[model samples]
Target: MAEKKAYPLRIGADVLEAMQRWADDDLRSLNAQIEYVLRAQLRQAGRLRPPVPTPAVEEKE
Candidate 1:
């Protein structure tokens, strides 16, 4: 997981309420909901890079 940086946001009350409801429906925290929506939009707009796949590890006999 990436370290989260805290930044104060200025959102309208109606938007915040809507986001809270969405987060509740999705079983996610409000912050996570906002990040999820933002990430989806960024991916759709090709503004964010795809995640890198981790290499598999070998087991010792």
Candidate 2:
């Protein structure tokens, strides 16, 4: 996992309330929900690339 840095954000009350509701519905923390939405939008806008899949390793019996 990558290290997480905290930053102060100034947001409107209505926006924060909406995010809280969405986070509740998605069963994620508010910070997680915010990051999720940002990442999704970035992918849609071609600002971020989709994650690559990891290859499965075969186990010996």
Name the TM-score of candidate 2: 0.86
Candidate 2: lDDT over CA atoms?
0.94
Write the residue-wise lDDT of candidate 2 on 1-61 in tens digits: 4589999999999999999999999999999999999989999999997788788999999
The all-Cα superposition gives candidate 2 an RMSD in Å to the true structure of: 1.2
Model 1 agreement with the true structure over 1-61: per-residue lDDT tens digits: 6788999999999999999999999999999999999999999999999888998998999
What TM-score against the true fold does each predicted structure earn? 0.87, 0.86
Each model's number of backbone clashes?
0, 0
RMSD of every candidate to native, in Å, equals 1.4, 1.2
- Tell me how candidate 1 scores on lDDT: 0.97
